[model samples]
Target: MGHDHAHGAGGNRRRLGVALAIIAVVLVAEVVGAAVSGSLALLADAGHVASDIVGLVVALVASTIALRPATDRHTFGFQRVEVLGALVNGAILVVVAVGVAIEGVRRLLAPEETHVAGLPLLVVAAGGLLANVAALLVLRGGDRQSLNLRGAYLEAMGDLLGSAAAVIAGVVILTTGFAPADAIASLVVAALILPRAAALIRDVVRVLTESAPRDTDVEQIRAHLLDTPGVVAVHDVHVWAITSSAPVFTAHVECDPEVFEEGRTGPLLDELGECLQGHFDVTHSTFQLEPAGHVDRGESSHR
Candidate 1:
């Protein structure tokens, strides 16, 4: 398990490096294109790429931090730090989107003249889009389960859309020297960014606040464990993420007072852990084995 964990971290770190390089290249290209064409769409893409750079840097740092040993000061270690970093990335993404939206609106209000025709715009815009797509493909696997990578991946995804919007706008400007199309396209890119930023913020907020996973119901978990073999009742249940990939659960399990004292509680706790792992993917568990009727049932754990 330890070796596998080390390998995963190493792999993620390597991928993060690659992604960051790609974003750096894209940012420079997009900013130059924005300057040349005076297109808000190009500038908005630069902003998205900026977020990607920050997100990837955060991810790399978090990945390195997570590999550190669990010290007494941090009992659960730095796993959740990754989640916190991701939360910050999410918030930053939303802020970037707002800024981009403002730029788009400004562009809409005062359209800028651009010699938008031909090769320079298309070449840079296509390069940015291709870079974003490559980054997305690089980080694709981990995005589903890892919030840190997801934030980065989402940034890349957002960049892809934003870049494509810029490309379309550039093409339109090239065909007909109408500068308003660039601003309109930037508005469309900002709209795309809005929902993604909101959703990432919500998910990361839930994790940082220790909210239960949406798919796992605390009541249902308690009820299921109560029906397990040799279990008198269950209470004081707590379930939350240690990171995007790791969830921890702690609960007080009421077993028969006599049977639990000696080693009887071990197997029961094992079973409960197994059940939790199977059903909820909770990887760490702490059970406070208690006697029956010890605590009132209604006062279990926090809901």
Candidate 2:
């Protein structure tokens, strides 16, 4: 009646750990550069990097917790902790972006009051860019398969763009003596962060709300089940995700009475399970097979 598929946390903890180390080094460098050069762009980038460190830490801890085996009290185990960790990472990004944007705008309005040392800012930003590039590569391999990894990847990407912007701002200030370029670069960093943060939060909300994965089509699955040879109808079909990689499904499958009478129900169930696993990528599934004449006393209410 049901099948269980094991989904591991993958190599995400190692990826997060490596990314954390790379970003921590960058954060310290950026903070010192921001102080010495008096560059708001560097300062904003430092703050963002600080948040990235926190996000990576949360993701690392969550990925570790997710490996716990299922118990009687928690059938799904702690896999959803990764989603909750991603939510925290997303929230941190939003806060950092808003704060950076506010400070950027104020600095833009008073460019004359800003004093930035171009050469040091440029040197430090270029180094930060390289570090971010390395971090991105480390996190890239698993980002698409895991929400927790994707959250960390997005933050690394934000750092990459922010560092590039700071580099450009430094060049402009060094060549044209335009101090407002630093503020503009900080604004650009904020712009790059917000959309990605929103997307991550949106996905986290979908998982938390028990919504079907974006790529799954419930009607298509119903049609597939109905098209099977012995299946007369399908009802009470439900599909949702425990995490990005873990999907759960359940349905009541009305079958031909002859299928049961002839002892063919086992083969029919096997076919249905294969269809779901092969076509829908739904590894965890439960089917309540019944003859056409079967009646569900009170359970039919929802169906």
> Whose lDDT is greatest here?
2
Query: Worst lDDT window (10 residues) for model 2?
Result: 1-10
Q: List ranges where model 2 is wrong by over 4 Å.
A: 1-10, 293-297, 301-303
Taken over the whole model, the C-alpha lDDT of each candidate is: 0.76, 0.88
Q: Quote the lDDT for 114 in model 1.
A: 34
lDDT, candidate 1, at 121: 65
Write candidate 2's Cα lDDT for 193-264 as tens digits: 999999999999999899889999999999999999989988887888989888899999999989989999
Predicted structure 2: lDDT: 0.88
Query: After TM-score superposition, what is the CA distance of residue 47 in candidate 2 from its true location, in Å?
Result: 1.4
Clashing pairs in 2: none
Model 1 spans with C-alpha error above 4 angstroms: 1-6, 31-44, 112-118, 261-263, 296-303
Give the per-residue lDDT of model 1 (tens digit) for 1-303: 346556776777787888888889888887887788675456656766877688779888987887786789987667776777777778877877787778767877876533344456677888988988898888889777678778877778878887787778778777887777766776787788779878877888788888887666888889878888778877677888767677668888878777666777778878888888787777678888878878755764443
Model 1 error, position 66 (Å): 1.8
Q: What's the distance in Å from true for residue 285, model 1?
A: 0.8
